[model samples]
Target: MTDNTNNTPDGIQKFSMNYSERELECTVEKEGNILHLHIDNNINADLEIQQDGSLIQTSGPELPPSNIDFIRKHVLGQDAKGSVVATSGE
Candidate 1:
């Protein structure tokens, strides 16, 4: 019998984070200049790239400003597609 495996799409990746002693597992998808953060199988953040290489949360959960900034710095401008800017629980 044939079985259906994980149905993740192309250009998408999954990873986890350690935030304040909490483990946050999620996926990341890159589209245009935005890195979409998915958590619990749902899109959590649509981080928009700014001119200065910073990212702004256009939608999804209202992440704390510090958490947003932390992720922004981790996102390499030239290799954003390969880089992930994970968030924190708090």
Candidate 2:
């Protein structure tokens, strides 16, 4: 969980990820039960908690299994006990 002291508006969380070449500042928009990830201006994804306690990406760019799990654990802040749904290729 993030504190309001981070300068983000209430309900919004921000984090940073170290990629191969650069560090990316990530933003998460919480809307109801959905968590919207803004990896950048264009690259984004929406994850929703399913009835079975699974986290499924219902929209946005096709990310890898590792990346999705990374979001689920690091961004969503849980080692999801239920299924962590993957994209088509995964």
The list of candidate 2 runs beyond 4 A from truth reads 1-10, 18-22, 87-90
lDDT per residue (tens digit) for residues 63-82 in model 2: 66566666656644563444
Could you tell me which 10 consecutive residues in candidate 2 have the lowest summed lDDT? 1-10
- lDDT (Cα, tens digit) per residue for candidate 1, span 1-90: 211111122256655655445666757676656767776665377776655455667778666665555444443323332222434432
* Model 1 whole-model lDDT (C-alpha atoms): 0.53
In model 1, pairs of residues that clash are none
Task: Give lDDT: candidate 1, residue 89.
Answer: 34
Q: Distance (Å) between predicted and true CA of 68, model 2? A: 1.6
Per-model CA lDDT versus the true structure: 0.53, 0.63
- Ten-residue region with minimum lDDT total, candidate 1: 1-10
Please report how far candidate 2 places residue 42 from its true position, in Å.
Answer: 2.1
Clashes in model 2: which pairs?
none
12: Cα error in model 1, Å = 2.4
